[model samples]
Target: MSEPFSLLMAVYRGDHPVHFQKAFTSSVAGQTRRPDQVVLVQDGPVSPGLEGAIEHALADSPAPVLHHRIERNVGLADALAQGLRLSDHDIVARMDADDISLPERFAAQLPAIEGGLDLVGTGMLEFLDDDGSIVGRRVPRTGQAEIERYARFHDPFSHPTVVYRRSAVEHAGGYRPLGLMEDYWLFARMIHAGARVGNLAEPLVMYRVGDGAYARRGGRAQWRSELALQRAFRRIGFTTRGQYLRNVAVRGGYRFVPEPVRKAAYRRFIARGERARRSTRIAR
Candidate 1:
């Protein structure tokens, strides 16, 4: 028999009606090798209609769904931690309720895990509409050393697009609440601990960006959060310039540049930066 891969999903009231169910269903239905078990932690009581949505979605799934319902909301990191604790497979992966996974996502990641990478993340496409339509692609550069180097400056791996070895996450003490920077905190710990991380450089998920409970906060609040992340990055050794670039990427880059050029430019700049790092490494 083949080994089982555990997919841990954290769902909450933040998920819009039917959004999480669609994501969950898509994950299972689209996978090349179905996960051994899917552990979903419902962060809190969602809308009354949500249960029906989940039930209808899971009824037809190929994999078994293990649902954990929490009475109160404890934020994202805590919810993820609880879900991770419930995962009992060699491999672990994350999925957001509002996102859609490509069929080959797990297939692409399994090789990375088997290749000895502690965490394997893939590129993502963003959807502006509620349905599974791609608006823009978030392409991440591949390779372990390059991923680490880029992570020092910015979050090279999108959170929802990652599949990780369970051991590495345990080594990092699981996820922690850091407001808007929780994923950043965990990823940094994984990198600093010498965990072998890599990116697939392919869009394996459709992430629904700038929506849900957090969407109403407007640009100024987001700017403040970015500033907070910049401050947090300082504590972790990211240069002031890197922090500034991240700010620009989130605040200015997305808003100003047209979709056609922005992502292409982002890819080019990231590739250029990685090459520059390689040069520095050889020089040293």
Candidate 2:
């Protein structure tokens, strides 16, 4: 028998209703292997349109939907922590409010989860917000060895594409208020605690990259947050001092570069990675 699981997500005022509707439609109504339960956390007061969208999506959902509302904005990390606590299933899948999970996302992830892996995530295709054109793809390192090695320098899994064992996450102390790098932080802790992590090479989610997404990642405040996260990882023995310094030099350099240069560099890197992934598939 297959292991039953719950889907966890958080929404807030800033999320676009249309995008949220698409996200919900894809995650719930569109999944080939449906979740046993769905837990949606309203991080703060949402617009009436968003409320209607949530209502409309749940009106026909096959799984039982549990909607938890927070009186005010508490950010994604805190909201997700609350949702994780509220979720009743041992296997919980994470989804973002504005991204579309492919129809086979849950189906593809279940094997890894049931095969004793503590955490599993898949690659994602990124699309632009304006015309929804394919912008790039993120194919993170897969398998226990590759994932553990990658985790030393970067996030080895896509946050929204991940389906993790609830007990493992809780054992790692669950989610914390770790600024923009909360997911990274949790994964680091999980790895440090010897959690078995894996990644599906196939892209299973359509991630929306807004116009300001790259810019948002390049600011001084975000740079500081990234540096702090790296330092914390080093202190916790998740990453070595040399690795932390290398990460700081590379990641920090991008934050100070011109926005256009940074954007171009990111695009180039994604294009190369996507090409390599496609070539490997063809070779196989």
Candidate 3:
């Protein structure tokens, strides 16, 4: 039998009640293999409607829910680190506040962990609206070597689709406050620390793409974060000076480009193996 796992998620006042409810239901109540427990961290204050939504969704959860509240917003990395500690199970699965995890999301991931992988993640489809039609697909390299190679350039795993061992993650120093690149930074450290990792080729999460998503990928703040990431990667010898310079030109340069150009580059390279845009309507 697969080991028990905790489903971890975080929510702030910015999260919409309706979207949170959907995310909660699909990732927990609607899953074929339900989690052993739910660890929810409220990053900050939430509205009454959102509180109501959380209460209703907890009612539908298959497993008991463990809750945490941060008096102030501490960002995703810090909030998630707290939830990770609160999780009783060694195996932990991550879910975004607005993404829809397919029913079989953990069905494959958990067993792969049992099979010895320290971390495993799956591909995801991006949706623009709540209508369920997929706008794009992001599939990372599936093989072990492919993942190791890809990590040098981009994030090798889809964050929301990740299921990982707590010990492996903690050994890598857990999540740090790394601006928007927290997930990327953590995965890089895990790889460098010799943690076994892999990816599922099949898409298991419907990631909600919000407005200004491309623009958000650029701007001064993003550039700063990208610089910090490249520096950190180089300092740890995870990346060579040559690789670091190249990333600054390619990935770092991605931060200041115009939104239209950034969007083009993202779909062309970052999306990886995307067959154009898949408009297939995903069903529950």
Candidate 4:
């Protein structure tokens, strides 16, 4: 673990040129404990504008850059699996094109990669929009017991904020295509394989939820969620209580709630997260 580790960042052309560049520069170079090497796995052929952002970000990056561009648009699962195959470190951290990392993300996480844990992820501050403005945080439970309990319900940690041991991923059979919820799919498999998982009680990355694919909610999106839940249930040999509860809420409470009321509830969830982080510093 002491030799050095690589950070694998995946960039789909879905991001705007300015925001993508800002995230790459701020998250990679701006880390307090910088990665020894950084890999930018582009999901498809880049646009002229995105190409420029990639160029500038790499040129200015403090870590060595490894750029992999695919001819076609491979989905998230394949892209991340390819990045993991290309990584040469014991630890491989995940990042997204549209999100920013806090300075102490890895510095705070690397030490926790001790003993038997296969992966370590963090709680995250989620941005309400693409402007890096904070909306609220998702505070994940850390430690083997709590995370294991959480996994029985859903994904144990935030997908983009994890630093995982490569060996553990290989054992879990790597990331697979699961339409919209590849990260959750992988997490379920890892837990079933008896890999030790933990979440750091820190907001290492800013997750942009409503700005992208998650912004649209319709039949297709709902179907994808249903499929993801089914996959999770199959993996664990039982239906998830959390998924059932969500369905009940959406079908029952959400049906009666006004659109404004639903939006207000979500905003309050995020704001409350921000308030929680204000009292606890995950850094030592």
Candidate 5:
């Protein structure tokens, strides 16, 4: 028999109730090959509506839902770590409370893990709000070599779209409290530990990118965190001093720039047209 997988998700007070419901429904009820277990961590206190949605989704789900709660807000990193501990299965698939996983996502990812990949992620379509119209797509670099190269400057895998072996994560010390760069930090450690990672060429999740998303990426705190991560990469030999400096000069400057400029740059560089083309191809 194939190793069973558990879907791991963390929810907080700030999450929109409607989005949370849709995300839960899509990940659990909509999956063609549903997870054997769903491990949900309540990061902190949530609104009654959000709580109700979780209850409703869990009540309707076919698979078992293991719910864990923290008394106070411990943030994503710690919350995820807690959830990871609670997950009973050897394979764990990460899901964001505000994103929608496509019906075939689990089915597509299971084979990769079965084939000996330690970590696997898929492309994701970024949409605006709850209407689900695709605004952009993140087509991550596939293959171990390409992923390792991209990991030096950027996160090659979309966190919510990734399915990874629990043993691999445990070997890398699991998730740490790294602020906005927590996922990236963990991925770096996993790569350094010789974890085999890859990304499927097709989008498997609908990522919700709100208007203020880019604005939130800027600011001194974010910049400091990013630079610190780069420095850590250099210290660990994942990046050269020259690469670290170049990252600072480029990504660091973006943090100080106006939001409009950052948005424009994001659309031009990070977002790609390939998702639309892929959708078109799938339609025919």
Candidate 6:
């Protein structure tokens, strides 16, 4: 086994029990290099079935487990913050309650840390369910240059595939409760703070995006949240004035579009981002 590390996850009542069970099995119980401790935060009260599932998964876990229950729903960012604090290891891996991590996920991510990276992430494949019909594949920027350049307008890492040094993240302010863009915000701070980062351009996690995901991508509230995030990025010099305007014009407007339009644009954006990453890699 590799050096001891912790796996962190948060589950809420909204998540299905079956999906959570499979996620725990595929990401924790079946890992080639399992975590030394699995720390899960119950973001809020969950359904009885989901509660039972959590208990069952822990009972069958390969490593020791810490299950923390919150009195009320605190959302993912805050919940993950609590979980991160509960971790016992310096290195921590992240998993979602609904994603299926490959058996070799940690096996692949840990070596990147060995190479001096403080944080490492990989690409992911999006599927509708465990039936395994993949609907989308996301590719991440492999070089630091590409990652920095791309972050002005796009997410450089697939959130679920990230394995990071807890100390490095804590130095960068840990996980803040940013609305809608928590992961991106944390990554921007980490990059700006000069944290060493790397990415594997290969998919290691299977992200579950069920029906109506595109439709749920937009609303008046979502636009407001995104607007706030952009303003914060601008205030912190994470984005140039022109980049900020472009982001507002592009990502901001994306919130009000119809479902069909959002769905088409979403796929195109993914493809364009992947192509851009490839070009940047070649240039490097």
Tell me, by TM-score, which candidate is best: 2
lDDT of each: 0.75, 0.90, 0.89, 0.74, 0.90, 0.89
- What CA RMSD would you report for each candidate? 5.4, 1.4, 4.0, 3.8, 2.9, 2.0
Q: Pick the candidate with the highest lDDT.
A: 2
TM-score of 1: 0.79
Ranking by lDDT: 2, 5, 3, 6, 1, 4
Clashes of 3: 0
Report, for all candidates in order, the number of backbone clashes: 0, 0, 0, 0, 0, 0
lDDT of 1 by residue, 1-284 (tens): 34568888887775775677768877887788678888888888877777777777668778888888889998889988888888888688888888888888888788778878888888777777645565566667567777777676578778998888878988976797775778877888888778888887667898775544233323455555656666666666654676567665765335344554655665576566456646766997
Across 88-172, the per-residue lDDT of candidate 6 in tens digits comes to 9989999999989998899999988867899999988889854779888888877888789988887788788999999999999
Model 1 worst lDDT window (10 residues): 211-220
User: Model 6 scores what on Cα lDDT?
Assistant: 0.89
Each prediction's TM-score versus the true structure: 0.79, 0.96, 0.94, 0.83, 0.94, 0.94
What's the CA error at residue 135 for candidate 1, in Å? 2.2
Per-residue CA lDDT of candidate 2, range 1-284, in tens? Answer: 69899999899999999999999879988999999999999999999999998898789788899999999999989999999998989999999999999999999999889999999999999998899998788887777887889788778888999999999999999999776899999999999898999989899999999978878878888899888898889889888889999999998778888889988998897777678778878998
Tens digit per residue, CA lDDT, model 3, 46-85: 9999989988887877889997989999999999999999
Please state the error at residue 13 of candidate 4 in Å: 1.8
Alpha-carbon shift of residue 58 in model 5 (angstroms)? 1.6
Off by over 4 Å in 3: 270-272, 275-284
